[model samples]
Target: MEDKEFDKLTPEEKKARFQKAVDDYNSGFVEVDYTFRSVASIRVEEAMEDAGRVSEEFKPAQIKVIYEAAKADLNLEHYMNPKFSASHMKFIMEQEMAGKDVTWLPIGKILHRSIVDKPLTRDQIRRIKERMQRAEPKDSVIADLHEKKKEAARVPKKQGQQKKKGER
Candidate 1:
């Protein structure tokens, strides 16, 4: 199917197709292996714990400064390195001191909210709102799928049990 044609399907139909594909793949009709590399799991856990201490009053400007410094500290290229720098380390410590919710959220989301909350020219606001409206359908579909998945996960399945006809 062409991409545009696929995009025209009702949300439920798209989900049903996705679920069937996953079920088939899981049953070994398709062979797939995925590998991912990331920072050590223990370190990631420790960082998350440290980030949790940042206060709600934390400033984005301060966070940006720390982020820049962190990029410098690990001798990472501006775009490729991940370790925190001395400045970032200090910011994290300050956040911890302030007793704030410093749990890290994806930077793009943080930036998006910051931008939308600020005063904007009428034209800018209109453009942003239009873009957001265009994006809403996809977001709604994703949310619906998440709810469905959660419902499915919560349902208990009996051992050695066969799914009833039409269950899938």
Candidate 2:
């Protein structure tokens, strides 16, 4: 669908259309047999749970197995393509530029790991953090003034009213 035409539908209608398309695709699916063994016989959810367990134990070998299984089952290659991943990084930079707090290190590490050949490194994480920090905005003078005004209002007033001792 063209962007203009797609904009005409309400969000709910758009979601319904997307779901229908997925249902139709699944119904028309076919299985192919190959000599190659499946990456792992586990379901995606189960693999993720296993990954979490391995992560808790800090075992890289166990984590690698789970990651491989997830990559095959979830088709992470397409979603984690460098071009797609860069766009997500760009979005995080934009958010930081707009004075929003966002962590880029974790996202960068995940993206680095998703690549089949390349592995994540500490240097990449430091670079991502540096870039995000550069994108952060400096404090505005007007915001400082507003904060001062609010702080002054919160102070208790001195007890020096028209009420003298023994005077009603």
Candidate 3:
């Protein structure tokens, strides 16, 4: 609200407005998915029963199997991100059911792309890190290199001579 408009409210009216805003914000937190809650409860119970110890360490073969299964289950991978809450998924699904175009912001698009994209191998990731380190402070070094390339591509014009018409 504009400062002048806010100034017109009495103290009790201001307090009521603030309380309503707080209630509206807090209401979003109460919509929980029972299925997700149950799954979490089961995992917590299992962890407690196991005394926080892994019974059998995952071998390479077992890890591959689990990874493939997760990839096949789209919902599992989408919800794996820490920032994706149950409510967000529900809202998106509701929009889809209503025949609306479900759009994502750039950050969400990048996150979703990363989740489903083929992952780089360990060696590839290592090489990329090395390259990034070699190109540290990207603005200065990269800009200089690009500038040099552009200079090389330019043709020197003759001194004291105007270009002919249509000579570019």
Which numbered prediction scores highest in TM-score against the true structure?
Answer: 2
Q: Candidate 3 clash total?
A: 0
Off by over 4 Å in 2: 1-117, 138-168
Please identify model 3 stretches exceeding 4 Å from their true place: 29-168
Q: List the residue pairs that clash in candidate 2.
A: none
TM-score of 3: 0.21
- Report the error of model 3 at residue 125, Å: 28
Q: Give all TM-scores, in the order shown.
A: 0.18, 0.22, 0.21
Comparing 2 and 3 on TM-score, the stronger one? 2
> Which lDDT value does model 3 have at 112?
17
TM-score of 1: 0.18
lDDT of 2 by residue, 102-128 (tens): 432223323322223343344554565
Q: lDDT (0-100) at residue 117 of candidate 3?
A: 32
Estimate, for each residue in 1-168, the C-alpha lDDT of model 3 and write its tens digit. 668998999999999978866674444222134222233333323443444433244344433333333333323222222233334443333433444343431222122113123333445434534443444455787787886677677967557777899987
By lDDT rank, best first, the candidates go 2, 1, 3
Best by lDDT: 2
Between candidates 1 and 2, the one scoring higher on TM-score is 2
Count of residue pairs whose backbone atoms collide, per candidate: 4, 0, 0
What does candidate 1 score in Cα RMSD to the true structure? 27.5
List per-prediction Cα lDDT, in the order shown.
0.44, 0.45, 0.42
